[model samples]
Target: MTTEIIDHEEVHAFTIRKEIEIAAPIEIAFEAILDELGADAQMPDGKSLSMKIEPWPGGRWFRDLGNNAGHLWGHVQVIKPPTLLEITGPMPMSYPAVNHVQYRLKANGNETFLTFAHRAMGLIQPEHRDGMPEGWTQWINQIRERAEQKARG
Candidate 1:
């Protein structure tokens, strides 16, 4: 077998962080996060992904495709109601990589500050890296919309 060495740039890691303010309480924002990332998960085009999060330490975060077939996105490393959540796993990478995602919430009177971060290392592909920011932003926007809608009701 022949050995091939990859370029340093091709194997580099990355981190993405985004902070958004929601016109909703911390609890509502947190619940919106769970909903958007879990049962209410969807593609940019609004197609449901049927995702699920067990919501406890060591719980599974995955997409259920039915018939016992699905994709394991990650495991809940930490979960604190109305405050923080951290998960570790492949998370849509599906390759020789490790990923950690965190959602932190802070309450400010009647508003909430939501901070999200995703860090990964390994053979991450160009397309995945390029698309992640937009994809994550879409999810974040959805969470904000959901929370704000509930708050307005």
Candidate 2:
């Protein structure tokens, strides 16, 4: 499994691409990625906050990262079960921003290839881009752990 960071000047966006072989079926991997609340909880620096997802197209995907410091409030833009899932939400920073996230899954024998991309729009510091890959790596690793555990049982 490898992780890569891509920076695009045209869109003024930075993307973190993580590829991990989870010891789980594709369907299970997809579910883990779509588990918004669970995923947030597993975030390396996340503090629970308040997360709720409707799990359908045009459904609400909202979270309050406690303390009013950062939050995610948006809707599920696209949902193709066990394959792709996308969500758009407000940025966690002070600047007016929007975040678009996508999860892609591919099945290989008994393993699953999962890739995630998070694009942040608006005023993003150039230096911040450099650290995004690490943050995403941690998140994906957590996802892999959870999915594999589910598969084992």
TM-score of each: 0.93, 0.76
Each model's lDDT: 0.93, 0.73
Tens digits of per-residue lDDT, candidate 2, 24-64, equal 99998887776644435544556654566778999876664
Model number with the top lDDT: 1
Which parts of model 2 are misplaced by more than 4 Å? 1-11, 36-40, 43-47, 64-70, 126-130
- Number of clashes recorded per candidate: 0, 0
Could you tell me the TM-score of candidate 2?
Answer: 0.76
RMSD of each: 2.1, 8.9
Residue 61 deviation, candidate 2, in Å? 1.9
